[model samples]
Target: MPARTVPQVRRWNCPPVTRENVDWAQLATIDLARARTPEGRAEQVEIARDAMHKQGFFYVVNHGFDLAENQRMIDIASVAFEEVDDEEKARYQARIKETGTYLGYKLPQYWVIANGVRDRITHYNFPRNVHDRNHPEALRPYLPEIQEMVEFTHCTILHEVQKLLSLGLELPENTLSDMHPFDDTNHSFWRFMLYDPRSEEEERKTEGVWMKGHADHMSFTALWSQPVTALQIKDHDGQWRYVKHVENAVIINCGDFTEYLTGGYYKSAVHRVIKPPADQEGYRRLNLIYFGYTSDNVVLRPLLESPVIQRTGLTKVIEGEHPTMEKWRKTRTAVYGVSELKKAADGSEYEIVNGVKVTHHH
Candidate 1:
């Protein structure tokens, strides 16, 4: 008997996004080097606060990271995703479905085919905890450099960003620091994504989108390797716009956990990626992302003492105890799975699956 051959789903052709359709605007950009002086520190804090409160997304430059290091990581990513064979890629496939462990590689189109748009993101996920000794053997070759990137981002970039966020919230400078200490068992992870170039015919079929509008479940997200302009964010006016990419800049955004901790003072931005125009679509897209998460043992609740919370009287925040990362993730996933219909602010009912809000066209 011959082995069975399964057919792959046709690549999703995302609707083409044009300048007329999307309200393109320059997102707020902050330079981390501003924190060196007292006056600059205060200005940077205010800038961070404004960015978060208004849109929950911004860009950072002069973040003290070397561009050569970034290029090196991208080189490694090219080898991992672009150069590897399918059989070799399968060696690091994550057991997210069976065990809810979010480590290792996730092949493209592994989840729902929403609106006939199958996501073509193939990624490798690395946890923030360096002591996690169970990494797949195939991923061991590139683990050291990846680990170095994770540590530098967590300790240097995210740490400083959190301090600014604390200042923005009018809380003690170190208020948000304790939640993600070096020794704490944080669930933050670094993700390296490869968006292979798609044909114009594929784009026409599904539209020019790669990812649908979604929010992350972390405290804050740090984005780099944005050599291309495909990422977009839903702004305050409910308009979709491109998050323009600038050379040597890191984009940051607040996530669900940050929103919860701030008692709704800051919001979790809804963002997605769209395929480039016909001319630019030929080049492959590589993304390096680091998301900051509260430690596993930390309780996710509103910081009641926060001046923003006090003034706003937003007492009711996240309900119940999000006891641990394992428990919270499982519980949330279960809730997103069973819920059939949910009402949005406009009273429109949409379907939910696996914690992703699905929007459909009539």
Candidate 2:
């Protein structure tokens, strides 16, 4: 482990972002302050359940942290990317291809976006327990802040949402939260991501897609709102709609693991990032997100004990023996950027991993 160094404030000018007019998707919004009471929790359960069953995406406000706190993390992330030397970053490069863990820096131009053109996205992932690993000198001083945000997101926000989901499923309040202990070994991580501006010709070659449309492999994802308007989600009608940026709100979405746990009752939202709007094309898009994974030892099976699931007669998403979180995470992470896309029977793109079929929508 590396010791913490004196915090150095690096001066890097982050480009300003502008919002443009676009058709934004109308999503369910849940207020966490109201959720603290029993009556409010009951009301939120119905709203959350409907959102999960329909689109698997929603908005959460009054989450205790305000827009200023969100911007502080983004500022630190910008400095980490802009000020860190390339030579130093190489020493901590992610071993996603070999080790199947996103625990370090991932350089830009790593993934194939379209037509053989690589992506212009760079990201750094800090695991749930930040102190257990080494980081760049630029990020060492801010490790405490990163750790605080990680714990707060997992223990405070995620647990509250999980309890509401459990109630929605007619199960005990702790049923879902128990599966994800904060101190347990899991693949959960906080990601600092940047989308570098690309030339119009390069963007055209990639069909205007920065990231392909796919569902996250984890259980839940909490994305802090930012100004750049590039994120979009595939609605239930198979239409793509822009995800509006709401200040001081965290966007919550279910993932494939959640879909499996609920017996496909809750579908995972498929989302993608495209070229920013014309007004924001010259500016870099910075993002802060936390991915919550189940404990390594937990099996990827539906909770058949839930009365809601029992009444619906839903079965497991994956048949036969279920894979543990460790196995599933490794398998999915190993093949993500390097896997060749295969055409499915319905004209959609897909990849098969561990005998399971995962779809990728264009």
Candidate 3:
């Protein structure tokens, strides 16, 4: 028998779409380069504070990773999803149903998008400590690069954002970052997402929505720009606006955990993925994202220690017992896409777990 040759996978060259064709959101851009100096850090803090408070979403530039670095990660992720055989991917399938952890491969059609229609997205999640879990054979060769990116994202970029957010809250600079130590066992992960193209019939069935509008389950989500035009966020006026793609920039958004910790001072961003526009509808949408989470033992409650939270009288005690990070993360992950969603009066779907309500919008 002859040895089989594996075809090479090429990186996706996604060009930016014309601005006039898209409804872009005007998001605040934070320059991380300014955070190097004390004065600059102070100014950046105010900018970040306002951005978080107003929209809970923003763009970050000059965060150390260059275009080539970003492209490298994207290239490797493409290989993992494109070149790897399905049988190999199945070996590391995530047991979200059995264990509630998202550390492995998630096969397509595993999630319910709408009306029992399954989603056409497949992804592999790498933990903060890359070696803590196994990966597919296709990704094994690039583990070193993957680990480097993961560490840089957590230690440098994520920490810098945490510091700004903490100072905004009038707490010690390291207060928020300390809750998510790199060496700790947390639910944080670097995800490689591949949104497969769907046929027109499938799109009609899903109502053109790839993923429903919902808040993230973690504290923060950092998404590297990939020029896809499918992401949209709900604005203060309750209107959905498209998230614009910036070159070599990262999109940061607060999640449910951040909203809980800040006593609702920082709202969780409600966003969704829909079918791409006419110009880009034929291509697959690839995304590289890092989900930042607190240590497993951190309680899901307001930080009453913050004067801002205290002064605003938002310190009302939550009705249920505070669930630790592990419990909250696992429970949410286990029920997603599997639980029956109850329709709310406002035409949204919701499910209450542990006294907290999780809502999904169309």
TM-scores, all candidates, are 0.83, 0.95, 0.95
lDDT of model 3 at residue 195? 93
Give lDDT for model 3. Answer: 0.86
Tens-digit per-residue lDDT, 187-208, candidate 1: 7788888887665665666567
How much is 267 displaced in model 3, in angstroms? 0.9
lDDT by residue for model 2 over 1-362, one digit each (tens)? 89746365554344445557787888999889999888998999899888988899999899898766676788788866887899988998999989888889889888887878888888999999989898998788898988999999999888889888898999998998999899757769999998988887888897788898999988999999888889999988989889988887899999988998899888799999988778877778888899999899998889999998999877547866798988888899889868988988877788887556788776
Q: List ranges where model 2 is wrong by over 4 Å.
A: 1-19
What is candidate 3's lDDT per residue for 1-362, written digit by digit as tens? 99644334477676566445777788998899998899999999999988887798999999989998788688888987878888988888899878877888889988888766898899999888888877777788788788889888888888999999999988999999999998767768999999988988889998899999999988999999788799999987788999988989989999888888898887789999999888787788999999998999999889889887877756324477998899888888888877888989999999987678899999
lDDT (Cα, 0-100) at 7 in candidate 1: 24
CA lDDT of each prediction against the hidden true structure: 0.70, 0.86, 0.86
Per-residue lDDT of 157 in model 1: 81
Instruction: Please give the clash total of every predicted structure, in order.
Output: 8, 0, 0
